[model samples]
Target chain A: MIGCYDFCGHYEWTFEWLSQLGGHTLVRAYWDEAVHQDSQTHASKLIREKGFEGMKEYWGPTLADEGAVYERTVTDDVFRIDMHECPSKGFLLRNGLEQYRDYCDHCMGWIGPLMKDAGFVIDHEHNHCGQCWWEIRRKDDATPASAAGELSGASDVRLRPGWQSPHTDHYERSTDPDDKTVVS
Target chain B: MASSIPASLPYADTKPAGHADFYFAVNATFRFILRHHGEGALRKYWQDIGQSYYQPVSKRWSELGFAGVAEYWRAFFAVEPGAEVEVSEAQDEVRLEVKTCPAIRHLREHGREVVPNFCQHCFFVNEAIAEPAGMTVRVCGGNGSCTQRFMKATADLPPQNLEDIATAS
Candidate 1:
């Protein structure tokens, strides 16, 4: 049960792409036993109880069968086409896709139609790709280490009150690069 | 007929070889700090030690003590919680009981090293990582859900002189 919340808008397109992955599927049911239309409720419960295996077992076969057909429809790489080509539509590729330029191009092409269909405001003013954004934010003045840390909220794990996990403390401590060494 | 100095010990006013040797050994030990613990962390840890940005600190490990060392380790390395920690003396300097059998298998089968699997909720390895066990990793966390096939370690490789470390044989 790959539980995903907020799938009402552009995520529907993502769901379509996910459907093509071999031996993976999305079921509109709970427990793979009960008939349920609310994918959110069913997905949430199914994820907590049955996990990814259950999601695959219920959805995989169907998606795998239609994999080729789905790929043909959403063919172009929706990301990495060009900032100018389709700036707003390119934001769909989110899985650290800096390596695969071709894949991003295909995704950008594929998702451009979907983005338009979804009615998201296409903002061309912001041409910054994810890597570019990272670099801009990581400038010395920006204090990116702290900003990144705060945004991630990787700190503040109050586990068992007064029994704070060392991991959380460690993360908080590392926020200050002066006091910490970034060892990969 | 006149002794220049009073001899209460084996030698008067002259330090023993062991005492001098201890200091010499400590000087050697400090090299490890520079090699691993970055100069910035060392400076922050020991503020008054006069560790300058230009002059990197390859000294002062003994002065920092165990707690300081622990903090250094915690900062530098990513350790999975369930990887059994065996601390001999200080709260730091723990021997992590990492089961590398799965990693070995992964290397053999996929030609890649596998990071230890961590539970989404607890951030600890779900079970003892062993051979024949699939390399299951943290799929999600409290903050956001993670999809399967996401290795805990990022794809970025660390800086290393691999050839120097490799055996000639």
Candidate 2:
């Protein structure tokens, strides 16, 4: 059987497989339909019912379970995560497994839709090398993404050395994964 | 450095056990593939994964034979949380009696709708892995529990009957 022990490995490979089968559109649909709707419905329900609190509830145990090194900074208006070490990306990096073009987009691919359904928007960025930050707020809040250390002080991921890479992708108040602005 | 890794498993992770929530994605992938590409395509996906992504495993089994099959399954299921399985090895074959399939049980507990043909993945994937290794596998029973036998290619085993496998709910 295809066990989940190496799920991230196969999951990343599957992205390339689906992309080859029906191109980028199929990959996007897989994330929205299979990932966001069918697979991660529990996350959808939690975030929808509880809003920002649900995100906390969801990511707290999830990141911990997946053995992520990160910090969460939350205020009344927004929920933010500073991922110093993302477990999934770390797994692929450690194992030298890269089949798809951009595996990180998958996060926004699913979570973006989930946030939109929950009446919120996201400000996010990730370096291809497994470090990223996410700031989520209610759609009507209109607060901009915070500057480095504005929310989490020393815990800010963007302030880390080499945080900005030549290939960082940024999403500003966006809910669609493809809405990223490339940074060189 | 290479010797530190488990001989049976091709990949290694920092964690001892896997995040069980991934089973949900596995189920969803099956549903999506079947819906879009149909059964033949779905089977091709499984076979492809077994041949490609699991190439390392096939190589190991080719070198180690029946002993490798037993060792691999034992270690494979060990990290799959909620799995209740026994891998018994004899002179000629190895058998896996899956008492509680982790994916099926997890999907069921979460009230997820399972694809009816989900059980067939094991056969197609394992067959692909075994064929290239000069071995063969037969899978019977399924849904939540099943039996899988791995033996030499020349062993006079009958062809697997899909009807013997239980359809997933």
Candidate 3:
């Protein structure tokens, strides 16, 4: 049976497989339809109904269950996450499994659409080395992403050494995975 | 959680058990494929993954034989939370009596709509994996409980009937 014990490995592999079968359009549809709409309906519902509080309710136990090393900072205006060690990405890295061009985009692929539907936007970046940060806010707020250590203080992922990478992908106040700009 | 993974598993992770929520994605993936591409494509996806993504496990089974197949399942289920399976190896074959499939249990608990042909994945994927190892597998029952038998290709086992596998809700 295709057990969930190595779900990340196969999940990443499936992305490349689907991409091969139908290209990036198919992949993006899979994330939005399968992941965002179908798989993560609970997250979509939570955020859609409660907004910022929903993110907290959804990610807190979920991340802990996945064994992520991360910190969440929430205020009335925005919900921020400093992902020091992303469990899913860490699993792929440790196992040397890289099938898709960018595994990290999957988060935004699903979450970005979810946030857009929930009247929010996200500012996020991932280094492909299992380190990333996210700041989500109301779309109309128009506030830019906070500087390093400004929101989460010392717990900010940017302040850590090796956080920057030539492959680092950054997104401003946006809700589309394709909106990312690669930073050296 | 076990500090060390069993040697039979091809990949390793810091956490012993996987996040159960991923089962939702698996089911969703099937739904996506079935809706857009159709069932044949979905089954082909399963076969491809079994042949490609699980190439290492198949290679190990080829080298180690039936003993390797038994070891792989035992180790595979160990880290799967909520799985209750008994893998017994005899001279001719290895049998797996699954009382509670972890994916089915988790998906059911969360009220996810399971794909009707979900159980067929076991047969298609396992058969592909066993093919290169000079073995064959037959799966019976499903939704929540099932029995899988793995034996050498030379064994006079009948072809698996799709009706034998129960449809998942």
Candidate 4:
């Protein structure tokens, strides 16, 4: 899921306004700023310590190896995994999130493909919460009918519900866990 | 034109006497129609109202947006007081305009910089766009071009999943 911390540049102006009105006591007003700032910093630190290249590559092919690809709006199952990034190496069990877990059934599941599809492939994956080690992957496949253009438009004008208030709480920042899995 | 209520219009605990009658009647009519027919009737009712008002109201139907007709009706009722309103089949596409009055008020009370609206990325999210990895989009609330596009979270699959050879292979 594209959380709030992705676009820090655009929110700088909003923060300036909130800071003036809130002053020192404007904890609510500065919450988003604080979250974005912290996430960016944390992400950068992780990048530096690992000496990884680019945002996408930071996870390395090792993480991508165990990836799963699901069909467009199909089901709660994964199709495949690379041996290098498999749970045998323990990466899947360590960094998995929870949002990927809840689904058609309450049972635990991975989000890889059991078969190969034509237009789409897995793009990014995360666990539901940082528990249970079930992997969830965000699939990136285009529909057959004008899928490319539709996706381009979908990316700009209509993604989430239009009525979401701007002041909702932002995503929380968690420090790198000692239990977190890292691959060289 | 309807009279503009003072910015500091007194907040009343009870409905105004004269307006209360129409308000109650309207509310009751809505409830009665909704109770028997469900929301379908209300939607049709509004559609009919849109059709009736389409011609006599204005030539810029699209510009009227959702609020335009609503405002027109509000103004019409204020003047006519007891006019019986009805609508028929109407063919028009109405646009909805987002109001930033709360944002405006916050700016006025607090300071110029206060963002009375959500972040640009958030705006995209509200529109159902999720990732916004590429593509250039211009934001309306403030100045500057917001380059982010919208994307979506992956869909959850159903239970008893099948390994579509298309997906699995």
Candidate 5:
């Protein structure tokens, strides 16, 4: 019945299906329209209304419910998350289900638009594994991503062993998924 | 929250039940497909997933017959938080009596708008999965609860009427 018990499986599969039907553009739209605007409207509403505090209220319980292993660091200027173990990506990895090219991009695909609407920008990086980090700030802050471990201290995902993959997708102060720089 | 684990489920995760928020994405995906593409495309997507993504399930059902269907549903529903389902097996068929559908209940409780054709997904998807196993499914009732029967192709059951399924709000 398309149950959520295995939502990650079908969700990833649907990415490729949508892309097959209408290339990358359609996939992007699905994330922005279906995910960010529709499915994740709760997050949008919260973050938009409460700003940094909303990210706290939204991600705290949500990540705990999804059984993610992560740490959140917040200050007057920024909200940061160090994702040590991302349950969604870990599910696909454990199940050996890879339909979309970069499943990690979906995070930015939806969150980027959400942040832009909230008048914020994001500094993010992911190894395509279950590990990633995010730093969200006001669009006018003009501060670059904190030096490794500078914001999160020992909890920084980039400082962990095996943090380096063959390629790491990096997003600077940006609010578009397409605005990414691939690094090796 | 599940008491037992069935060996037939293809993918296994560390958590007992999945986060219910995922149902939102499922519903959103259906709406997106229905809005951008036609109904035919949405049906194709469901059938395609059942046939392709669920290949292992069909293969196991082919090996274990009715027993596999019963076992798989038991495990599947177990992880679905708030699901109330019973799976029973007999000589020729397996029956799933869903007292409360987790997806529908969760979506409704949260006040999300569900697509009217939501319940039909079970039919198309399960039919695709059963076809490869030389089995068939007949579903009646929906939106919140339903009865699904998995029987052999030779069972001669009447074709399912779309009207039997209730429209989701």
Candidate 6:
């Protein structure tokens, strides 16, 4: 039985397996089709129906259930999250499991398409070390990502020491995982 | 996390139980593979994962035999929320009587559409894992509950019939 107890380990392994079988295109399709459309349809439905409030409703309990150490800042115009220790990534790191080239891209891979469908865009960055920040806003809002300590005050992930790494990947007002730029 | 996790488990996590929502991904992954690649590819994927990703478990089973299989399943099910299983070990075999499968229960409770061949994964994956340990497994019944028998390969044992495995809704 493929139990969920170690789902992250196998999930990361499956990414590399898919990539090896059909390259990056298959992996991207898996995220969009399998993850965003099929697995996370509930998330899609919530965000589609409730917008920013939906983001809060969806991530709040979900992150807590997954045992993530994170903070959320929500306003009428935007929804932001500062992830200190992402449970999924932290699981892989603690277990020394790394099969995919960039495991963090999976967040954008599924969430990007969901946000695109929800009429919003995202400004996000994740260091390979289980720390990241996200700012989500309406597509027409044109607001850039909040600076460190701007939206969430001192709770911003960027304010943490060693927040920036050579492997940090950044996205600016984008809804596609491929749009990231290496910060180093 | 390491201190809390049992030695039998190949992987460890900070949380005691996994996020049950991940069952959605497992189901979705099967549907995606079957839709795009076909059944053979899906089976191959399962076999490959059992052989490669679970290599450590297989090695442990080889080293410890039936005791390893019993310990592994007991520890594995302990952290799987909503699972109800009984694992028993004998001189020649390790038997698992699954009263409620966690993945199936979670998926069904949330009204997710399960893949029809979902239960076949247990056989394919377990077989792959057992092969290297000089053992074999037979899974009977499925969908929600099943019986799995792991024992040394013997000529008297009959080949598993796919029909014995129930199709998941």
Give a tens-digit lDDT track for model 4, residues B53-166. 122333222244333434443333232223232322123311223232222232234223322222322232222221121111122332211212112123442221112101
lDDT of 2 by residue, B64-86 (tens): 89888998998899889999999
Listed for every candidate in order, the interface RMSD values in angstroms are 32.6, 1.7, 2.0, 26.5, 2.5, 0.8
Task: Give the Å error, residue B124, model 3.
Answer: 0.7
Which pairs of residues collide in candidate 5? none
Quote the positional error of residue A78 for candidate 5 in Å: 0.5
- Residue A143 displacement in candidate 4 (angstroms): 80
Give the range where candidate 2 chain B is weakest over 10 consecutive residues by summed lDDT.
Answer: B1-10
Which has the greatest lDDT?
A: 6
Interface RMSD of candidate 5?
2.5
- DockQ for every prediction shown: 0.01, 0.72, 0.72, 0.01, 0.65, 0.87
Q: Which stretches of candidate 2 lie over 4 Å from their true place?
A: B1-5
Instruction: Estimate the overall C-alpha local distance difference test score of candidate 2.
Output: 0.92
Clashing residue pairs for model 2: none
Best by TM-score: 6
The TM-score values for the models, in the order shown, are: 0.18, 0.97, 0.98, 0.17, 0.97, 0.99
What lDDT is reached at residue A45 by model 5? 96
User: Cα deviation in Å at residue B158, candidate 4?
Assistant: 26
Every candidate's chain B TM-score: 0.20, 0.95, 0.96, 0.28, 0.95, 0.98
Candidate 5: Cα lDDT at B122: 97
User: B95 in model 5: Cα distance from truth in Å?
Assistant: 1.1
Encode model 5's per-residue lDDT on A1-184: one tens digit a residue: 7778778888999999999999999999999999999999999999999999999999999999888999999999999999999988998998899999999999999999999999999999999989999999999999999999898999999998879877799999988988999988
lDDT of each residue in A1-184, candidate 4, tens digit only: 0111111111222233333434433323133223222212333344344322322342343233323221122123322211122222132133221121112111111111110111122322123221122222223323122222142233311122331222111111112111122211
